[model samples]
Target chain A: DAGITQSPRHKVTETGTPVTLRCHQTENHRYMYWYRQDPGHGLRLIHYSYGVKDTDKGEVSDGYSVSRSKTEDFLLTLESATSSQTSVYFCAITQLLAGGRNEQFFGPGTRLTVL
Target chain B: DQQVKQNSPSLSVQEGRISILNCDYTNSMFDYFLWYKKYPAEGPTFLISISSIKDKNEDGRFTVFLNKSAKHLSLHIVPSQPGDSAVYFCAARIFGASGTYKYIFGTGTRLKVLA
Candidate 1:
């Protein structure tokens, strides 16, 4: 809770609808990540950005897209919602240090349900 | 295939006792590992981390041990409290060529401390 906030704590939408979830952070960290958590599966990274305008896909990037236009904001979008995409989404940030250690901070999370 | 795995879905421990949670990874390139705790409807909070350079790292009641040869790690919480009851996740990161990094997480282990 140190400065990260996720919008729309809970959402319900129909399949095939486009949905977007927003994650905002006040820490101004350099790295931001989007992840989804589901039963029997740990949190899987959906997308991540290293810097503004620099974004990349993660292990489960299908149907998901992310944009980081600024240091404090990272947006995750689903072009077409599906029941399988119903899960808890989390946003995380990390600051790289000269040393090898980097600690990540997470947001409260947004729960999405596709009907 | 899952790069990170947490076989135990849940663990129970008596208050003031020790609780151990295990995690395994299939990726050999991973050099950093971390543990996080999450409560109901909340995002994961950073707990502890260990690098391949060290086999163990401890902070107060929590200790993390890494076994690189076995690609395994475990978290030990001494004097487990009811407040410690939550889901724990293990994560790994591999640094990419361009100074970018990505995390892979295990499913998670729900820990219950019975008073």
Candidate 2:
């Protein structure tokens, strides 16, 4: 297992409230990603960071945002929690070897519920 | 439109039987494919992978076959065990493009191994 941890493994918030999920990794990996898993949707990328202060939006980035101010931390925030945003969120870090085989290691996950 | 699709939402297999999971993709640019397994309450973990250059790759009890002409891939688990019961996701990555290493995942198929 990777030395990755997600804060507040479980959270429940109300609609229109702001919620932030934090992902911290002991490994100084250069690539970090955030994904949400929902029924019939498997895992969808929410946002990802390639380096400190460098982030990009994914296919489902409409309702989410991410930031990576340091090498070991990546944060995902929901500006206003919605019922549709309730799901299991996972943080992952990618390690690329010289052969270009990029393997991703995942955190346990964070379960968020919006009422 | 979903670039990757896992048509079968679930599958069941008896212990010591062969389990087959299928996946299809619509993007021609996707050249690398991978399979990941996930148990409830945990994040997905990499299982096996096959590059587009090769049609097949095997690791122990797991084998991945790719059909580029059909734009499909399948994962076969021989002599399935109860421990193998989990949700399987098919993912792909497009190369030759900057920042395209992000994976596109299928909805996933839940596999159950009955003892």
* Fnat across every predicted model, in order: 0.90, 0.72
Count of clashing residue pairs in every prediction: 1, 0
lDDT of 1: 0.93
Candidate 2 residue-pair clash tally: 0
DockQ of 2: 0.74
At residue A33, candidate 1 shows an lDDT of 91
Best-matching candidate per lDDT = 1
The per-model lDDT (C-alpha) reads 0.93, 0.91
lDDT of 2 by residue, B46-75 (tens): 999888888999999999999999999999
lDDT of 1 by residue, B1-95 (tens): 99999999999999999999999999899989999999988899999998888999999999999999999999999989999999999999987
> How high is the lDDT of residue B50 in model 2?
84
